[model samples]
Target: MKNVVITGTSRGIGLELVKLFAEEDFNILALSRNAEPVSSIELDNVSAFSFDLGTEVDLKKASDFVENEWNGKVDILIHNAGAFLNKPFQETALEEFRRIYEVNVFGLIGLTQQLMPFMDSSSHIVSISSMGGVQGSMKFAGLSAYSSSKAAIITLTELLAEEYKESGPVFNVLALGAVQTEMLAEAFPGLEAPLSAAEMASYIKNFSLTGSKFYNGKLLQVSNSTP
Candidate 1:
């Protein structure tokens, strides 16, 4: 009977999460820039919605629809749609940085704020971050745009957890090391191997429902192999 609303459901972790959770009978509200199959004979519990999070107009519409459709109660809100611009700090353009933050930070905050009223005592807010967000990693070059934004997101989640404590919702971040998704291919193309998206999605599912009891507010890290 959990009501779940997930943004950025077109591809990568977001898409995998949508399909995986819908199969489990959670009432799903899926929003993405790309079209998702709606009214499926197979997935009767899914209501697929599409909108670009980088723009304000699209986000307003998405918020209105989701708020009305979900009817002022969301047990879980997963902010999984984000982007990475893999240019060195020197080469990264201001516009590219803006685009990265547009999706990673601004859009995410916008959607969360719009849905905040619906978050009740038991609501859970989960954001996907990265190990890059962790303190000064192994000196990887040309990831300034991504790492910085993710680091900020991690802090944002923590602060949000404190800010909304009265509502009893748990806002947290997951600094997953690396997973096989389109984002990975784009961020670091030609990698020999990476963790499968479905496998990671499964871990997220299990963790959210159970491990969360012991793991709230901690930057839970999960991978095929630990870094």
Candidate 2:
């Protein structure tokens, strides 16, 4: 069985992704700030733990789990946790902006660096980004902090893919448009997204399993509607 580590497994697409993987009997480590939801499921192939990307202790815990339990073999790593701030650029405080970057950018960088050792050439690192982050995509008014931070990860993914191209562990990012997720509702109240969380999760699961064979360091735009 393939060992997979997924962040943000408490809710939204992340939670759904965990369920789909568990159904397939993948050895999964599901990391979320609130572990109860996943833990309550109690699947034998799945392990749930509280993890905060900004915390060194939490990162270390995940690394230790991979090292000790999975024997340092991670077939797939999904960076799905995100921080959203829906406020005017001028109104968004410096700390709030930093918080967004902490989870969406710096935190991702930290986690990838921590787990990179456990990943080999066959491993795949898939990051979830936003369509607003894509250059020349439809820009949003109140997502300055959230969107820009997401853009950072898109570039980071490309850079890592190039750096590790010869060795392995492909890196790719998906720039999603809009999904009917809690984060989306929080960011754009009353807006109906074209896709549901489960629908997007299924797509991500399939891509994580096979996208590496055809693409690396590439950004796939997975949006049907402009947000």
Candidate 3:
């Protein structure tokens, strides 16, 4: 069976990804801050791990779980954990900016590094980015930290792809448009998103499993341009 590790599986796109992949019979290592949502599902192929991206202890525990249980061989790794800070540049405090980076950037790198031993040449690493970070898009006022962090994800993915070009695992990032999720709701109140979390999850599933066969280090943007 193919082994898949996904972060931020408590809800939103992460939750949906777990459900979708479960249907395809993949062994799922679901990581979330709260394990209740995933544990309630009660699937034999799915295991829930409670963790916080900003917590070093939690990250170490998660890596330990993967190393021991998964035999250090993962087929796919999805980085979906993120923090949002919707404050104007001047209003955004240094601590808040650091918090965002801790989860979106540092923690992501730390976790990925820990899990590298469990990945083979056929493994794929996918990070969910945002359109806010993509160039040529109109910048919003209150997303300085969040957008910049996502932009960092894109660059990081590209660099990893280059560094691992002759190696085995593939790296890619999806610069998603507004998806109707709690994160989007919190970031942009009352604005309806053109895409749903389930929809995005489906796209991510297909891409994670097959897109690597054709593309690597590509920042594929998905949006309806309704904003």
How do all models score by TM-score? 0.90, 0.99, 0.97
In model 1, what lDDT does residue 205 have?
67
**By lDDT, highest first, what's the ranking?**
2, 3, 1
Q: Clash pairs of candidate 3?
A: 72-118
* Angstrom error at residue 83, model 1: 0.9
Clashing pairs in 1: none
How high is the CA lDDT of each candidate model? 0.76, 0.94, 0.90
How large is the C-alpha RMSD of every model relative to the true structure?
Answer: 2.2, 0.6, 1.1
Question: Model 2 compared with the native: what TM-score?
Answer: 0.99
Question: Lowest summed-lDDT stretch of 10 residues in model 3?
Answer: 218-227
Model 2, span 1-227: residue lDDT tens: 99999999999999999999999999999999999999999999999988999999999999999999998899999999998888999998999999999999988989998999999999999999999999999897999999999999899999999999999899999999889999998988899999999999999999999999999999999998978
Across 18-82, the per-residue lDDT of candidate 3 in tens digits comes to 99999989999999889999999999999997788777888788778877888768899999988
What ranking emerges by TM-score with the best candidate at the front?
Answer: 2, 3, 1
| Deviation in Å, model 1, residue 90 alpha carbon | 1.4
Question: For model 1, where is the 10-residue window of minimal lDDT?
Answer: 33-42
